[model samples]
Target: MTDQKFDIIVYGASSFVGQIMTRYMHEQFADESISWAIAGRSKSKLETLSKDIGLSDIEILVADASDESALKMMCERGKVVISTVGPYALYGDTLVKVCAESGTHYCDLTGEPQWIRKMQDRYESVAQKTGALIVHCCGFDSIPSDLGVHFLQQHALKKFGQTCSQINMRVAKLKGGASGGTIASIINMVKEAAGDAELRRQLKDPYSLCPPDHSFSARQRDVKMAYDEEYDSWIAPFVMAAINTRVVHRSNAMTGNNYGTDFLYEEAMVTGKDGRGKRMARATAWGMNAFMVGLAIPPVRWLLENHILPKPGEGPSEKEQLEGEYDLRFFGKTSAGDKIKCRVTGDRDPGYGSTAKMLAQAAACLAQDVPEGAVGGFWTPASILGDKLIERLREHAGLTFDLE
Candidate 1:
């Protein structure tokens, strides 16, 4: 491992988020203190990315998502690989396979739970033996939620001597445009669930990403549209809750239920208080339901894909990415009736701008911060990276986790 040529390799470096991340890496590590490179299926695209970013000295590696030999070669050279190429269910399996077999650490921005579960089921054992620390949902989908919960719990223990029995996260504000890759992943998930009853059922479980032997059977709350007394606002389902909650639960399970077996967690978007809030909440719920229903139908899905959604390489412009931001609030309560509140805020777009930095920091953390002999397998960001990642996010990723 010490002989690895680079500390990290940014796989799929030609993708939308990957490009943003590459620029960020150049800005953050221009000193070349941390050895890194950019990689993708297209040598020309990778070269273009390097040129466009004015990163002439950065190395570029070419490897298609499904080309096992090229992927293996790429995996063998880096201690950690950051994958930004996604609809991960379609193009992510081979990279995970190669990384696990070669003992390379990995991180990605995938919010697809089904694909994550499949990877865990198939590669956990191999990664454990080889010491490959594969972590998913390192981006906007779950990092704020997973690490937000983790930050709150640490405070709870310090202040009250007991972890929270339950925690609720509400998105107070979010401003971002979705990328085509994100939409494609959602559509693919719905497409698969439309035909598979088992996958549909699994998607609904908050513990779907947790280990199969875990004893967690808590019936998690599902917010459709409801008035909340805590924040005094109407709340609606969070689009990322399905994957985020599962990742948080997996963190707890992996840490021996450090959050407690009866722990409860849920996430939603706050729609404000009173009449207007209720209307907004109802509208949000309806809109989400309608969107999912449309994606499930072949004709409607095709229409949305071809006409309504951004294409894979398209995303917010530079100004938009710089202007985008999010504010997330977390409320936690212990069994002893002690309560705590905190907020996690990002300085850029949740989906792309902020996510790109988060993913890059996660990969850097895996490569440079994780202690040697750390047990490796499938791990949630908070479960494995924990405080180290939180620090990295605050220091370099434009994310702030603060107690209120």
Candidate 2:
């Protein structure tokens, strides 16, 4: 084991979300002997952040995410790095390369599936060889979705002696806000990859989530049944459902492909609106769905590129993002009358605040606690870290993973 200077390094520490994570770390480990520092391209931004968060106790390093040499140097200084760089396709792959090459474990809060697929193909072998555990979706998009499946399946195994045959994650209700940074990242990814057919294909390919052998069809299970009598209501599409479900599938793929053996998995929204309002919401979902589907076409894609999306460096206010919250409830069933219900709740805003905390805890676990000789490579949040991350989130992040 390397006697690294810091247990964990928060890369991109100058960004809005990165600043939150850095402050959390400073608060989390104010007096620990384990060393840590902040790294980013702008020393001034980092200095400003340090002052804002009163992190005079922690060291700060200047390292650009785009600078390969700087990233490697940063990776060398810490056992693990939690990167908050957005869209990741543009600024992330380089950092992954550096960390994988240097044998430092890495974690990120990225939701760009295509970018993630690209990194897996390019770095899987190298990461395996270097013993770098490059884990992704350590945020709202996938954490609860993946771990929710894990927790439910574990219970199913314990109760019925069989894995959950089907899992349905429903966002019963949500009251939250989003960040400009989060919005910027999403638009950045769309603008960056919308031009490349191959990249877009990689993003949409379900099997491409991991290796071919890791593929599992989430739609195989029947999801059209009426909602449970308790929360009986019509469901609609979750804005982030696409990203979250894919993460769960990837999680199952990483864990020997057994979580959903012969199981179908999906996520949906529990539209709080009912009656006429629910009908309108459903119609709106149809329109949104139509729009998303149309974006797949070349001409429509072109229009979105030219007309939509904010330019680079423009994203959400810290206050708005920090105030957001998310609630996820899942339903699981087996053929043998075994039923399970699980929920994952996050307190901080989904796009920025909660995501930052989720990522920080994930990286900190890998840095300060993950056992040596454990499997290392590209993995989803749940598959790579398992209960360790769940526990830490509860203890440190105020995030809850409850099974009932």
Candidate 3:
């Protein structure tokens, strides 16, 4: 293996979220005795971003996704690579492959389930053999959900002598907007599923992301409105549930079903406290269903994507990010009926600001804290980083993990 020149490399540093992540690293961790660099396909753009973000002297590397040699060379220099580029299925496959083969750790913010499954199928064995920890969904889409479940299970075992057999994740409060990359990823996901039957089948499977022979056959909530009697509130389908639930299940599989062989989990947006809340929940649910249907139609999808959706590299302003916030609560119950509830909350917006910080810390945790002989393979953040990441995020990323 080539000599490691950097502890972490922020690949795709020219992308919107990429710039945020690199800037965060410079601002927060520059003096922490870790070597890092900003890299992407364009040297000039990287240089400009560095100057704009007051990181003018930061090391910069250029490597396009299409160039295997350049990517491999880039992979050789960094012990851990943080990739912010996505619809990762399109541009991230090569970098992940290079990292696995080169024994370099890797992390990304991809919420694409089918693509993640594809990566696991092709590279998990190689990464395990080479000691490369390949972790995905480190950002808002899955981190809070995955890690929240992890934290809850730990507490469950400590308090009840067993892991939770069920977890119900509720979005208690959220105020955030989407970025262009996220919109594009969702659009691409729908388009890809439109033609591929197997992909559609996989997308529908709750066990799609879990390892074989550990599939949990339990009821799950889809995109439909319902009342959550436990919360005494009306609830609507959460958009991120499809991706986040899969990541949580993968964590369970990675941990050898430590959570439980019959674990059941579902996610929803808790609308309100009373009858008014129930009315709003029904409307929200129907609206989401309509939106999904509209996205599937060619004309509606074209108009919405072209006219309303943000284009690539576009995002909210710094002020908006600062004002954004989210709170996710997970309620768990053991087979004996004992219960506990915990929360994961972020100070900044979910899609960009908080995500940038979470991704940066995840990369740092892998680069600096992952113990030797950890047996690298396809992993979720909770499965590999666990409490180490929870601590980093709480200390530096403006996140809180609390029992309620």
Whose lDDT is greatest here?
Answer: 1
Residue 346 of model 1 has an lDDT of 100
lDDT: worst 10-residue window of model 1: 1-10
Candidate 3 per-residue lDDT over residues 1-404, each given as its tens digit = 35658999999989989988887888887686778888899999998898888885688889998788999999889999999878898888999899999999999999899889899999989998999999999999899999999999999999999999999999999987777887788888888898999999999998899887775777665746777878888888888999999999889988988987678989999989788888888888888788778888999999989998898788889899999999998999999999999999999989999999999999999999997679979999999999999999999999999998
* Candidate 2: 10-residue stretch with minimal lDDT: 219-228
- Model 2, 298-320: lDDT tens digits are 67766655676443344456665
Off-target runs (Cα >4 Å) in candidate 2 are 1-4, 192-195, 215-231, 290-323
Clashes of each: 0, 5, 0
Residue pairs clashing in model 1 are none
TM-score of each: 0.98, 0.88, 0.97
* lDDT of the structure predicted as candidate 1: 0.92
Task: Give model 2 RMSD, 1 decimal.
Answer: 3.4
Tens digits of lDDT, candidate 1, 1-404: 43558999999988889989999999999888789989998999888888888987787788999999999988878999999988999999999999999999999999999999999999999999999999999999889999999999999999999999999999999998877788889989999899899999998888899899999987899989998899999999999998998999999999999999989999999998989999999999999999999998899999999998887778999998999999999999999999999999999999899999999999989988897679879998998899999999999999999999
lDDT of each: 0.92, 0.75, 0.90
- Which residue pairs clash within candidate 2? 177-324, 180-315, 180-316, 181-316, 324-349
Candidate 1 — which residues are off by over 4 angstroms?
1-4
